[model samples]
Target: MMRRLSGLLLSLCLFPVPAFAQSKPCTVSDHPEYTNKIKEFTTESFFSTELVDHLPLSSCVPPPDAFLHHIIGAPDTLDYTKDINAYFRLLASKSPRVKVWSIGTSEEGREMLVAAVSDEANFAKLDRYKEITARLADPRGLSEAEAQKLIAEGKPMYWADGSIHSPETGAPEMLMELAYRLAVEDTPFIQKIRNDSIILITPIVEVDGHDRMVDIYLQHKKHPDKPPYPLIWWGHYVSHDNNRDNLGVTLALSRNMLKTYLEFHPTVMHDLHESVPYLYIMTGTGPYNAWLDPIVISEWQEMAYHEIEEMTKRGVIGVWTHGFYDGWAPNYLLSIANNHNSIGRFYETFGNGGADTRVRTLRPSETSREWYRPNPPLPKVKWSARDNINMQQSAILFGMNNVASNGQKFLSNFYLKSKRAVAKARTEGPVAWVFPADDSRPAEQASLLNLFVLQGVEVHRTERELRLRATESGRDPDAHKEKSAEMSAEKSAGKSPDDAKSKEEKKPAETVIRAGSYVVRMDQPYSRMADMVLDKQYYNVSDPRPYDDTGWTLGALRNVKRRAHAQSRQNRCSRRHRRPGQNLPHPAQYRQHARDFAFPPRFRSHGSRGRFLRSRRPEI
Candidate 1:
């Protein structure tokens, strides 16, 4: 089945099939005599009852002092940090299947935790599994034989993180319950998941915001007349947009999450949230984002649709596809994972009020005739805490089942897609992108290099200055488009194509690659992702709109001299330079160095000179 799917995808990529007309299949009749007349039809045709019967059955056991129980009986929402930590800690302390680690500290002095839940045996050797996944992802340091060995040993790791946004309340609670079920339930399906895969669950990504939200909700209940202010920032530095820091990775939370993401190299990852729910999954409200590789999107859709089908068969209501959310923004953590050749899914459940209080909100089916009501006018429906919890639980269950059932295929797809990326870079693209290290702006150069390192892009430094083939004008697609537009307008106004641009402007320039210049080459395993981040990506925003910016060139942003290099006749590899910060001086350090040496260049600040002069030392 996996081979068939892989072949189909490869064929589609190599030779796309055009639209073909098809005739409708014979239909089954509801009439009793018609059931017998249609041999292919039966009562269980739409959904196989036999498959559901064969599913691993289990009993749900509520913990004696479950936090959900306490929350239900309590008058107001409670601080999740205290209760959540206590619950997970207790579970880990008691169950061999569960292990908890504090991944990092949040902005407001709270611990961010990730719980690893697997079978007891897998939990014992979890580090081995993590290492295998990491090696498989990069493969630079591994021999072909060694890579094959690791691939055989590797188990798919599925990551799901919650509550990155404060108001998206369902995920944290659902994760707690899911953790309990995975740890306690001895069902064959749960056991298979534990045995075949490792589940990484970060119950709350934004610890500070969660506590703040709880406070706001508890306070709001006390004064019903006062308006509720449930929304709070995930980061102290950048408000609700902290989740959009995958590219920059400046915030501590994003840094921590990236560390785990790269470490485990999860085959599938989920960033859980509550939006204008109407039940939507990650690949979004429209066609899958154009930037994503088609093969991966095909695999992801297969996995998601299967789960949705199962959910529907079991009578889970309002599970929708294609309504909201576009997957264009790569800065989103989920899309970041997708760029890394993993199946990254976004789970958006309908959100109620902060404390799971019943609130008047619009259901998808509801409509209104009021003058103020717009198209698809949603009428009010009361949503409760219980419904939110159940929906979230359903999402986790479907996701886990998907991974458990398709673990090997997921692993194969990840490896194959990466291989395709490497192939594309080697056979198709320009040699590499060279960011010439700016000696004058050492700090900014160092910052940019560090960003590349954070993004897991392999980097090389030149041993000596060398002239390489380089583009002159623009670094982004839009810039190139603008340049072409200007030339086109000139040509349209009766100017010859050659006369439209001067000979000097038409020719490519040779850029001198400095000794410390960073080289991100094609042919590396993560070349596609590196290209996406560093190169100019074109988007058809006029048609199906992108969620965010189409082109994001980190090289262009830092004011570094960027050059598109063709394959060098001479070998480009040189001695590896890993330490970016040590090689370059920071801007402040540059000023301090300038002051001590009494340099001719003017510094950014004058007040610093007095203090620097008092503590003058020999500049490096």
Candidate 2:
């Protein structure tokens, strides 16, 4: 059935078909002046006439109108997920600049697709670019000169996704247009973006929610007088909480995104959202996560401010930054990129659930001018799906242009950040973290270690018991004990206690790690991410309230015993005998081990029911 439908869709794309009838198809004649105003504003302000005039629209490739039967963002209109996928397929089928593939399936079993739009030359050498980014992501063996050579040869990869929340209808619609522009338009601006960077577009992140929301939206439109139908949940399991699964990566969508990040190593990852006054590019209100490199924070501002400045210059109002969210939490979906030494930012545009034009009145707080928001939105104004689409599409174009123009700088910065991470392990402390295997909870321990491996953090297993002296002053318990004894003797001999205690405090301690432990050395490129996950988070009390959970210490949550050792001396027992996956016993093995343990007679299970059916009588 799907194949038949796909064939029919291809036929429609290959040969123009008559417009499909609808209960109410939005047309230019309905509001010709408003339509033309938006069209002119987007073209002249976003892509100047010089660039637009140079764009070569191809007859072989179908525009969004060919599939939707009306201009994109048309009022009172929505496209099905299947139709959107069909259009993307057609684009890839017709254009050398576009390549589409399924990343994975959604919770509801709908295919989630990602399109890579770049120069035809780039598509031919895509594997080479992937290898370049991977090498840069981990700059262990490369010298400064070699790193610079790779930087010059490599192109920056940019990732942009839309419709994560589903109700933010504008982003998904705008992405289709953006994809078409990137694939078909051959202007200098577009060509430069294609030549300099690989653009990745995931039109809809939450596939299930997109289709469900569209259904509810159409129902609401059909009965204007009745109370709107409620969508109990957006995703099958959660609503807005879908974005909160990055660290856990329990959801299919989060896993798929993380896989892509690890595979591509994109320099910048942008997620499109809606709900702010006009458009809010994320620079993030602090206190920022201490684990993040200083460079990552600065890069966030660099991208955000560039978008704000360009949009403001284009006469777009209400584009602002730095007040909505805090950067302390690393649980967001895009936070995956941020933690991995890549820039991850997002946009929040104003949206009305559907394509209909509606009047909205902003509160005084939202309208007042501020340092961040130079030209605030009006107190009352007419807004529509089309307006939302225009703002988001323009901001995205500006962001793409920024990265393309400064590809070398972005790539160089990525290499530098990764190199610094490795250098930190040598200069700073906490040389390695040890997760000791526990007999009682082997499964839990393995699960925690697996999480780290999944995040691309290197892990190794201890073949034997490891003992090393703690070199840091405060870390040595044995040295402290010896110092205490010496200090007591000195005090008894009439010496000052303070002087003796001071001398003892400078001594180093000793630590012993058991056999079968998992060691995660901090010398790797993603050491910061490993530290962020395992170490305790301390949120400042004086700072503003956090946007989400204040802390996410994985070890405590998983009930695993993990130790961060600052010892500088190398130990033979910490050798890596086998891969982490092979060393860690499977969950079933743990269960079998539990079953093999002999229980006390009174507590033993005697039958298939597996209960302590009989117990010895207590002796009086």
Candidate 3:
């Protein structure tokens, strides 16, 4: 019995969560008729009492085993975690084409999983790929094609999940309704979706934190709830609240899981979280605000918010995003995190920014102002300006110009250029990719270039003073001394080589944090490199945007100047190393001296902030 018990534990741990494990059986009718069906179950109707009495409440227990998502006990918040997982399980059960995997451990060590829904049988038949696709769009409408064409063409098949923050529970709960529609085999809607697009889901983006909330609710009010369950799970890890960002302890876990997710290069990324009340009365997080993508902003607004607003017209609370509380999770994330949380994060895949809303969820007069809701005009303005600000940020996750391309094209470009430049100086080469946008880019700006040096790159940094720089070889001082000497002389010489030594060499150099190999170099004049503060957004969920240590809010840009002396003094968030063109005389201080900076050419204010400030409030 002991051996068998241990074996069972091992099996559960190692075994991939089977598709059916995400949900249980459920009866779903056409949701388009949702209004009529719900009307029959309203509290005001004569038979409302009978209908209410029959409603399921099994989740209120020690928590329903994989099936019944939740059962309200008194009156609080809904069980978002249970509902989301259970609903996903149902999706797995009815759909033969889907597969799911729990990718990482959460803050509470819960299994964070994802579902890949595609036609496996069709995909298996390699020879039929083209034929199958052609048939889906057959002019005669009689070709026996499944949804292969839609799959190939990459039409928008929405993939959204929620609650990176546990208490912002509505999104995961709402996902249940979406899951029920897609999972059942017999439903016309389910069939149509499967025949049209392959869907992927990571239902509980923050499973560990979410479960902590769910467990507390289950322990208290649930067994002992009503139509609504508030103050959910008063116990549990309160510190874990709003932990959508990577905690210092969980760095490895976040890195690995995110890397795996990147393999799929998803077209859309929905980072769900709850919204605060009081500050935002009208609506909550939502689809494309004008701040992120202007061209398709209106389209997304129509497709998502229109449907969401209609849901609001009914009894459904907290459905859409607008002026009252248009606090958008995706918008904030994409702005600073560099589009990984925004709509056009498509190089990662387009149409990605996925977020949630707390619009009508709160009582009309009540206030849950924990969320950062800008005033009416500000949020709307931010929504509109987001596209431009976010486009500026996109350069970091990928590059500038909203152009997305993958594959190695420029790794050797810097190395080759540096090698030639060093050969001409006949000095050991200091190779680096440069950028016009990175914070450190300013140091490398307009100057006598310093050698990046031969020290190991420190990928991690705890403070602004201590940064990482690229190192070509192991820790051997003599070898570095030789290289540093030549490199130092190259900089000490007042004049840059008049020869147009390949702009790759002549253009300023930079050092990159996170990933990407091109356009990086040593600080403008010193061997010291700039460090990217990668976890800015993770540390503060108040603004769930993506960014590295080097990142700053454009809100911060107003005080900044292109020159080193001016920037460190002007920008509060910024740290200074030295004036641009200040070369490091010593090799040992390179790591400690390197600092991340930002002074994009765009930063050169076109005239002044009087107009710019009002024009670019949001990060679209």
Candidate 4:
């Protein structure tokens, strides 16, 4: 019957049949009563369900002036170039509730706005941070404005950033819409959140990347140097994948902005991104563990975790954590540096394994399938303007107003536990786990000590096959020295395999190279994800991951990127240097570390906390 049905379809395609009456056909309907009915029937067809998804993909188009309009009490648009001019214009106007500033600029020369949304009282106080205006003068660079503004006037602040991933289309629109609703509407809704809080919003962090998208639409041209990462399609892609360089070596945009942001010590922050193939909208596609300490978790739970829990209970969204690499740090949690209590979460408009049945249903529905789902720390509330106020209230300043200085003490305890565990693993774990062991002394083991500290396992070494192992103690205490064959033969025969411990299962006594890549691997793991909140620093890099690139070394696996970049520069120099037999100086001068790139002396004022890091080495 199946074969006959297929054959009939084939026959219809092969032989052109008459649409009307099928002339002389005593067969069309095969029933005397149905012959007339068959003639009256009309044929209409659409793509099959399976074929429908396969059709070209479609994206949601957000309204124009998305970012500028988000600042409530007023809605405005300013060209990326004329942002400062427009900002001052607002400052000069009656929009007492909101003020805008060009807080950071991207690698592409586009300006990112920092909206200071507050009530009249807060706005008057925000004016104290005028150093932001100094940066606009073009000497310090605009990125420094936010910090300089706060520092110069010594103003306390809270910040929210979005669109570090240009493709994380959700946040730009979400945040922009938020800014708009806040600006355009006047109600108890926006007032509650803005009363005590002054929002320092960086709507677009990666302007260089965002411009790539804008370029494709307007100029019909693609930049020669686009960072490589997953795109709309899993198969076709082109990028150096640079934005992940949160450290900022080759790209100065995020790197510089991060430095300035840290100075302000914001209390609230959230970064956004679209999920890649096999990745979660919440996190990467590796493991679902988070680098958070119990204290960090506790803090978030106190403020934001409850909200997420409520949302999950209500089934407004699916559980945030899933997939192998799903567990990782949310960029916004960096608020701790400035004593800010922040929760970073992701939104998934689309699922990882491609669109499922719901996606199909939503294809014709509204575009609010996924938003920020706060699981444990955030209080469950409907996604609305009032919730934004509630979110701001959860900041360190506000949280402190409620918890007092104990908030810091509580957060400190949580971080210490997580940090101690890691420090111990780095100190006592077996040689494999010690990693590029400390090179303080001239011993082989000491030389093996690594200077560069890697995050959770990542592909670093270009060569090596490795695996993971655990033990009751970090030093592999379970390991026993081997006895002579004659001494062990008799006892070995009677011993059960289960009674004997194997290398792999012993509670991770030490971490070892398990697979591809070299020494570069993540020191953090899902098991210790709860530990990330203990310390945000990488032991080596002053900046955070994915944003600061200066911390990476020039040897080992990192050598590949450094070398490739140098080679490119060398070619450019060689071309400009040689003039047909003109000898370009014999010896080229190599600059020292700090001189290579005019990095200001990276220093910190001495304080009691400095005592702990004084030894620098982990006292595990």
Instruction: Please report the candidate that would top TM-score against the real structure.
Output: 2
Q: What does candidate 1's lDDT look like per residue over 1-620, in tens digits?
A: 99999556434422212211224422222232212322222112221222221211122223413334442212245546756765676666555667787777887788888888888788777878876776566554456677666777778888888888887766776677677667765567677788888888998888888887887877787887998874645458476787788888767688678766766778888888886543455556444545466777777667667666666666554555544566566787676678777888877766764645454667544343222112232355445554555556666677787788777777877877766665554466645766665655555565665666566665676777766555421233335656788877887898776675575486657556676567766656666776777666556646476566565777666655565555544644455543211222345655566444322222122111111001111100
| Weakest 10 consecutive residues of candidate 3 by summed lDDT | 611-620
Q: Tens-digit lDDT track for model 3 on 111-215?
A: 556665545453344224323222221212222242333343332223444555555444454344334333343434335554444445666665655666565
Which of the two candidates, 1 or 2, achieves a greater TM-score against the reference? 2
Instruction: Kindly list the per-residue Cα lDDT of model 4 for residues 139-208, writing each as its tens digit.
Output: 1122334433333333334455544555443344334434433333344534545563455656566655
**CA error at residue 292 for candidate 4, angstroms:** 4.0
Please provide TM-scores, in order, for all candidate models, with all chains considered together. Answer: 0.76, 0.83, 0.43, 0.41
RMSD of 4: 22.6
Scanning candidate 2 in windows of ten residues, the lowest lDDT window is 611-620
Candidate 1 lowest-lDDT run of ten:
611-620
lDDT at residue 586 of model 4 (Cα atoms):
14
Give the distance in Å from residue 207's predicted Cα in candidate 2 to where it truly belongs. Answer: 0.5
Error at 348, model 2, angstroms: 0.3
Instruction: For candidate 3, give the lDDT of residue 428.
Output: 26
Ranked by lDDT from best down, the candidates are: 2, 1, 4, 3
lDDT of each: 0.61, 0.75, 0.31, 0.31
Clash totals in order: 0, 1, 70, 80
Better of 2 and 4 by TM-score: 2
